[model samples]
Target chain A: MGETVIALAGNPNVGKSTVFNGLTGMKQHTGNWAGKTVANASGHFKSGKRSYTLVDIPGTYSLTAHSPEEEIARNFICFDKPDGVVVVCDATCLERNMNLVLQTLEITENVVVCINLMDEAKKKGIDINLALISERLGVPVVGTHARKKKSLAALVDAIDGLPHGKEVCRTDYPREIEEAVKIIEKKIPEDCEVSRRWLALRLLDGDLSFKSEIFEREGKALNHLQIRRAVSEAKMYLDKSGIPAENVGKIIASRLVEKAHEICDGAVTGETGYYKTDRRIDKIMTGRITAFPVMLLMLAAIFWLTVKGANYPSQLLSDFLFGLQDDLSGILTKLNAPSWLHDCIVFGVYRVLAWVISVMLPPMAIFFPLFTLLEDSGFLPRIAYNLDRPFSLCNACGKQALTMCMGFGCNAVGVTGCRIIDSPRERLLAVLTNSLVPCNGKFPTLILLISIFFAGSLFSSLTSALILTAVIVMGVLATFFATKLLSETLLKGKSSSFILELPPYRRPQLAKTLVRSVFDRTLFVLGRAAAVAAPAGLVIWLAANITVGGATLLQHCSDFLDPFAKLMGLDGVILTAFILGFPANEIVLPIILMAYGAMGTLPDLGSTAEIGTALAANGWTKATAVCVILFSLMHFPCSTTLITVKKETGSLKYTLVAAILPTLMGIIACVIAAEVMRVTGFC
Target chain B: MNEYISLNQIKKGEAVTAVRVSGSSSTVRRLTDMGLVENSIIECVGRSPTGDPAAYLISGAVIAIRSADAQNIKVRRRENG
Candidate 1:
């Protein structure tokens, strides 16, 4: 037999990707707990002697083309015509998932229903009769706990055992609707890849996407005007039969749901006890009085753990990595290496790499897993559920709340996560505002500034945590304000409504989640930062060392930027460091220290007090520190995030806006702050 | 004659049967696809503290719908209790 192509189809949160991973053994990051998968990923696996290629499409509630994900799934199934489609359903919620299964059956004849998450169902006292369901639906059905390899073998066997050229049992619409579809079916070209009845039903239900899809597939062979005429005739006939024009789709949907109910009545039995536990948890987590406080406390705890926990490890890594620098310098001296080469390699590139890794790795190691834990445990959607009203008030979708949480981890990832929002305008608003939240790279700088400048000797940790939390809260509030402003002016539109499903809260697989996050997110992000930091370090070293007219190039650049930087309550070196730190935010302080010429290498200031002394010697004051913090929180994203924004939006216009928006906000904020402090004599 | 009320009017823990799921075609279809068809048993599970989007238990799924969207789904209190 030839290679069989099987498309994995399902509603969101159905463990479809788990089944794919089980069969293919490829780790494609599954959807967020809310069931939003942005991209289509494919993997190849072998079942017996026949090789099977599996395409993982984005999950959607229906194939009506209300959203982009739904459109992609619909078009791929209609046009690509995979050999057999595997419709995976969550055993606990078979009826809700069966809607997509019936829709897929309409599009293709070959299908096998893989009931996934059987263990979760069994634990919840839910029993699904697989053979009964298969007999009723007239399709092959297999049960599997997708997370375990042993259980998926049966599903693999079912895939290879699918029969071809059999009659497909499709959902039976009402008599009048079936007659309308019959009329429209005769108009569809016979040579089309999709089934004529499916096209007829979609067209009569007022879905025009298939027309364009057919045109794209078959150029000018099908008459568009004839199809439009036939669709109008079908709608008029339905209206004449006492059904309202707009209610055609509703009538069709209800009929399909009735079929689903009939099949579910005989094939499924469950107590639904799991929902009580989920609801009890939701009551407290989303309780109005408790929700805001719980969110705040969670935020504070994560940051506290990150800040306090990362300090010792950061110090250890710094000591270990920098300790090697001395040994390398000793070898260079003994071998009589050139001084410039020694300075460039050791002081420039190597020091920046050490600094970036030591600072970035520790916090990322703590933050990503915590974020993933929330995501996996499904609390992230509840957070979205709580924040939806506020986001709706701002004329944006509520899913922006989840995307904003992603921003707290890394702005680039957050920007990409905007795909969760189905509306274009709101997604753009999210992409533009994501960088307001400080990412892992900016955390160290913000924490250092808060510690040395705001927190004194007594109660240092507490004061630092409180101030950092306040800064984050301010960034979040700023994001809301900017989203509102952008919506009211640049992207004026009504907020699109969504049916946000609060998936049953499940016990997070902590060990697997941590392992996946560490490899997929933390290491991946750290690798990107290191890639840029090395070259950036070389440039910084050259600019500092290269003399031009009795002053190094770094001195000349800083002198040139001094007047403007001073006007904004900063020195030329701070502005120059920020400009250089575009490659990676982790290297900003090292660049500043290098420019100060306090030592030939990045300094190891032991305590906040020592760091304060060094900055005080460099003409820093309280006003400067405050401006620096504000600037750090509001500056352009690092080079990696900018490139990501470019790639995600695919528009230079928005990418430029993403870069300029935050910098302008930072400059305006810093200027206003400086003016206020200067006039009030507060600093 | 039977009294009909929209889903938004139902109190928490009150059971009702859907009489009509109405809205734009897409919204109505989405509601039905979520198993909100006529005669399906539904109960108001809980309301968010702000109380705009309320969770409803329909066909064993807890779906949160805003008040505006919930207004489109009409229901009647269960009888013969």
Candidate 2:
């Protein structure tokens, strides 16, 4: 049997990916769309002896080409001409979704309307008349609770039946639109594969479809002037009908909406009044009085939980990994390996790898799932809704709030999430400022610094947690300021307005969120950090072990940096450690510990007293701790984030800015902090 | 009495009928495409914590619109007789 290509299309936040995942199972490849930052995922499935390749297009509200995602989705359906298209709709909000479905129908007849989220709809007492909708639209309607595998079988069956399905019912437009479309339709070339009526409607609606895009696949040059003249004539004809040329698009959109309403009149019934639960929750969550405080408390709570949960596991992992070094050394002694090789491999390479995993993994494993829970519960959009004004004030996208939240888990992931912002200028602002939020890797260092220097005697853990939150709050404020400055100077642009949809709050799928965050986020970030840390560990080992003149290479480098580091309230050893820790932030403190010769390997700071004694021995004061913490919060991103920023921006210049901008900030901040502490005699 | 006003002027929990959606082409296209066409009923259900962009119940979807954008969407208050 011949293979079939199916395009999955839908409105944003509708469970299109759910249905795609249900059908394709685990056979999927996710990559950026050709020459576009937008991510595309494609997979294959088998139905009744036929292999089907499913392309999951980005979720878009319309095919009007107002945004890249919408354009990509529209281009795939119109130009690619897939064998079947599954138009997924949110069952709870079928009316709004019908606009996209109607648009898809105008392009291809081999389409199926898959009403997803049927479980949510059923729970809300919304009954959808699938057969009635199918009859009305003249396409197969498959009701699916896409999350449940069993419920998707009918949807798969509908796709299988697409080859034998009835003729697609074209949406009837208003009289003025129909007359203008007829004029434009006569001008479209006869050999075009896209539906003539769709092309005519697009031309009338002032679509920006380039002539090259129209016939690029056919290797033919289209008569661009002919199409433009035909479109203008259509608009002129509609203008004579009293609808202005500028308003033609609205009129066409209204006609399709009117048709959607007509179809929904009898096909959708039941108590749609049960949004009361979501409303009741939103009342507190987004209420002006409670929102800010609640947001702060939530941030602190997640951080505190991560700190508490990761402490023991990180210690155990470190102990276990370091303990393996002794046994390996014992085996090496029997094998008579060179002393330098043993030391380099075990102490330098293996130890740093272990330290990164032990320190970075536990926090990320805890933080990412907590973050995903907020996302799955639909609270992240509310955060965007609340912060939209502030972001607008900074001339950035409100969606930056979502990306910033992702940054808290890892800045690299946050940089990737910047793709959601439509405007390139705003996205660049987001990408550059994303590193201001301290990620999971930096948490270990911050927590250590705070607990050792700032934790008060009374309620130490709570005090440390509050101080940590304050530092994060400071980082967020800095992000806003930096974004403002960048917008004003480097990347000037008006703030783009967006419709932030606060999706209906549902019970978060805890199990799926955990598995997804663990593998997709936590493990992915850990793997990247480990890959960089291994080579870094070897370098750190070589520097420490290799002798230069009378002193070791590490000692010589630290000696060279001493004066500058001293001016910044740090010493030569600490500055050299920070520079060497560039590959991953998780190894910074461990590097410092190793350089201090406090321990031959990364030491778990058992208590604030032990950490304080070590720092004190190195000429550290409260001022030094303050400067280090500030510097740690503001410094250049780790190697992984820099690579991600480079990949995302695709420019060496911006990547350099991403690295240098924060480093400059960190240096200035440290200098000021150190000077203030010195003048105040606090040191 | 039906009084024409911008959508931003509508009070929380106040239901209105969309009279006309006029703004930047993209904004207008987006609003109308989301089923906020003429005579379609919309309700201001909630407001953000900072209280600029309010959530409106439109076509069974909760869409958050900033006050600036909301000002462009003219609506008429639906008074219960």
What lDDT does candidate 1 reach at residue A563? Answer: 92
- Candidate 1 — which residues are off by over 4 angstroms? A1-3, A163-166, A330-336, A457-462, A599-601, A605-613, A647-650, A679-683
Model 2 clash pairs are: none
**For this target, which candidate reaches the highest TM-score against the unseen true structure?**
1
C-alpha RMSD over true interface residues, model 1: 1.7
| Fnat of candidates, each listed | 0.59, 0.73
- Weakest lDDT window of 10 consecutive positions for candidate 2 chain A: A28-37
Interface root-mean-square deviation (Å) of every model: 1.7, 1.6
lDDT of each: 0.82, 0.80
Give me the candidate number with maximum DockQ.
2
Q: Report the lDDT of model 2 for residue A547.
A: 76
Q: In candidate 1, how many Å is residue A144 off?
A: 2.0
Candidate 1 CA-lDDT value? 0.82
DockQ of 1: 0.64
